[model samples]
Target: MTKALLKYTGEVEWTPPAIYKSSCKIDVLYFPFDQQSCNMRFGSWTYNGFQVDLKHMNQKPGSNIVPVGINLSEFYLSVEWDIIRVPAIRNEEYYPCCKEPFSDIVFNLTMRRKTLFYTVNLIIPCVGITFLTVLVYYLPADSGEKVSLCSSILVSLTVFFLLLAEIIPPTSLAVPLLGKYILFTMIIVSLSICVTVGVLNIHFRGPSTHTMGPCMRKIFLHIMPKILFMRRPPYNPGDILYREDTDGDGYIDGDYSIDSCGDIKDGSKDCLNYDCSNFKSGLHDDEHRGRASVADADNVIPRQLTPEILSAFEGVRFIAQHIKDADKDNEIVEDWKYVSMVLDRFFLCVFTAACVLGTCGIIFQAPSLYDNTAPIDIQMTRITQYGISSPPTVAPRL
Candidate 1:
């Protein structure tokens, strides 16, 4: 049987299997809860004019569907998607009596991103930093670290926002839920920083910088503290506030007085009530009175300030007035410190409420995409009017 067989040829043309790589675009507007649809179109390039025809091996639409089998190792990559539909149609050349016809396949895929990664890395950190903003008020201003701590937290939040921007694509169609949260957090932190700076400025103020007016002292030291529910430190009589010497005695009274220097004695008359009845009358008595007056004046005022010549009385009066004014201003400075404390308590409550509301508003706006079976917007069609030479049109729905 082998002797009767014909001889075989040597060379044969080999055709490599066609491999297609599709270009896919991603949309991250609704990231961590976003949905995407990718298309993979298949067609033949060689033998276009009816010599080679492309066909779905199976006629049913379900039979032509290809399953996506992507398996990523990252646990944060819990994204789920599906190859939900596959549509096939014919494309014939739009020319009279032309024979170029081909089959086209368009695959539709839909996916939803899981939020595991964002919840752990983005949401938690942003939320923690937001609550931390309130701590700026809790810190004592005397430590001198309130502004520095608040500024550091502000810079940290900005760095986190920059990192978020790098991860998500730049798009304005929709803001990501986590991105909104971060933005809200950034605003709150910035406001907290401003408050911290203001509080510190108020905290460090003294009589040398600003004099607290009587109306301001009454409102801030007494009324505002009650409204803010700030606790008053236990009253210590030992730490008594300085008072004006209203009785002309060498001691101060326990009441605030606008004209505080009434204790100074002049020409044997009591300055407190401006009474001169205690002086005795006579020319010889006047001579003794003048000498006694200078000696008494040295006792009432500082000897260094009162000149021995008796003619430089104006210098002693000027020095005593300056010392009185400084004491009065020192009292006002103490009242201002109390006002700063009351303001700190007030803003602490304000920032806490703002943070809570902003966090809830930003996070809950994201839509849920689970168990959705809506029809996809993908379509595939053929050019039925071949003789008209029009552009290819979508095929009629099957």
Candidate 2:
């Protein structure tokens, strides 16, 4: 039973006169998180940042409390606070700003099954997207497919770069572990794409092609691995063209002739005869003929070379030998023509080296992220240190 009184003339009055009596307190509650496949818990928890957790605007008007001062005499207060979620990943360390006075309340961390989601989802996917640049090489250099692939990869790199930028805080401030690795890999991938475009330009004999200097070639050869070979298998004679080795030997059999076995061109396993002269000629040269073929015509009889034509051939061959010397002299002036090819190969080598180095650099530079320090003790000590003191007063309230 408390007596309620108002001091007008002399209604009621209580409580001894004091200089001032007020309270300033901070209350914090760390939220428990739901587990996810990703190893990291993203977002921040701070006075000012951005987050989407606990802000009950109307909860008892004070449960989510950050009371600066409570003046029971005259109520005038303002609360300045914001909440954010801090991400913590395994094998990484994170220390909260505990020495900031506040009543801490931490909900048990939601144990999530950590995964290499950064590597698996973001990194690997970016790698696959980057590898698309390599696929462009399979297309004919002169075909539109090459340009299309390059343009597409460039656009993809731009999007990925933008995404990486979004997740990163700029201003030379240290970037997050995930962002750093992602950004590094993306940079290399983007450079690889640019190099692919250059390689294609040189392959297509574009004017932008430049000679690869000897110094650069030597440097590339120095760093290149002894077994650092990444190439499509050589074109097989039997695979792309044809072979006539009846004895299963690699060389064409000497007996291979159209006149010797005509029907055996069907390539029957049981047929011991094989004519490969037709194969040496391109498929375009195999013109189909009617049943009474043009070859059977009297007017179309194959004429043997005349003595005059034979002599002309001999004379032409003899004169070509003299021209060979002239051709050699001409090549001296145009020796740099092959320099373009050398430059193209050099650019490819440099681009590949950059990619490997950049990716490894990211792997080596990733940072740790973890947090286990008890925030309660930090808050208590901070409050004690910053607590307002009474100036030699006999008694104090709060």
Candidate 3:
């Protein structure tokens, strides 16, 4: 009893201090943004409503019609939870063993979770790591680090999931919003690894190993490069064309041209076609002209050395042809590499869009994330009227 009335007033007041320990079922579909309502029932179990009726002490002045909920004047605030409201209602139930009804007061304590801790520690880091998947395509394929980065990001996400598992309940009823987002990100990272492998394969292709068809060349080289805004350096023919005077003679060592009949043309007026079938005939003609000039001048025949000189010229032409073929092969290999670069740029754009849309779409699905209302205030009274008091004496303390 908080206060005692006069001896003859026939009135009394009671106040009891007690502690309660209870558990409430939790719904974690929204996780960090979830709100929970826990109901606490208070009533006397031994007495029925007819003998010991329960009444709400905090009511409006001069009226027993409106019932005000519990007081919060001494309620301590929590850092992680915000008290949304505390509404109390009176209920009466009849049991088979009792004729009268049993009345009880149910206080519903509704609270909203504060998201600052989760946003900084879990959500932001997950989002940042998920976005890194798109940048894997931006990295150069030749660097050889794309797969390593993807693996590391996958591991990090798994760690975050474990941490989250420890924090939330392990019920398999429904996956949380954050869990869905993490799983989606892991799938994206795994897909990125597959894409990186393909890009590397395309980058390392050679002309001898793989032949690029016209359709592929048109799409990867002509069309896709334009869409991706990729441009190759200007072509220079002089860079690939080899020119060297190996013998240090007045003329270039391998300065020969191939005609339509596959004949090597050495710069001379008479020897227009240097085919092996007509080599002896052309050499004999040159020797005959030389002998005639020598006979006409000093009766001396020129030495027959034309066959050896022609064989030496053929060797030089063969080396020059090999060099030219190598240059063409290098150009083809460069085209394949450029095609790989275009694909990388294309995937970069695609993964970036997917990451952004997936993050926004999954996170905003929570209903309470958009709530901006303030916590409701419950009025408190210094004194409470539980039952009738004789002589109309008021309680000094409650």
Ranking of all predicted structures according to lDDT, beginning with the best and ending with the worst: 3, 1, 2
Best by TM-score: 3
2 against 3, candidate with superior lDDT: 3
Runs in model 3 lying further than 4 Å from the true structure:
1-16, 44-52, 59-68, 93-102, 234-313, 376-398
lDDT of 2 by residue, 163-190 (tens): 7566433535344544554565556556
Of candidates 2 and 1, the better by TM-score = 1
Worst 10 residues of 1 by lDDT: 69-78
Instruction: Output the better candidate (1/3) by TM-score.
Output: 3
Better of 1 and 2 by lDDT: 1
lDDT of 3 by residue, 301-376 (tens): 1243255654654565675466556757888888888988999999999999999999999999888888876764
How do the residues 16-57 of candidate 1 rate in per-residue lDDT, one tens digit apiece?
244457777886656766667677665665656455544443
- Whole-model lDDT, model 2: 0.38
Query: Which residue window of length 10 is worst by lDDT in model 2?
Result: 25-34
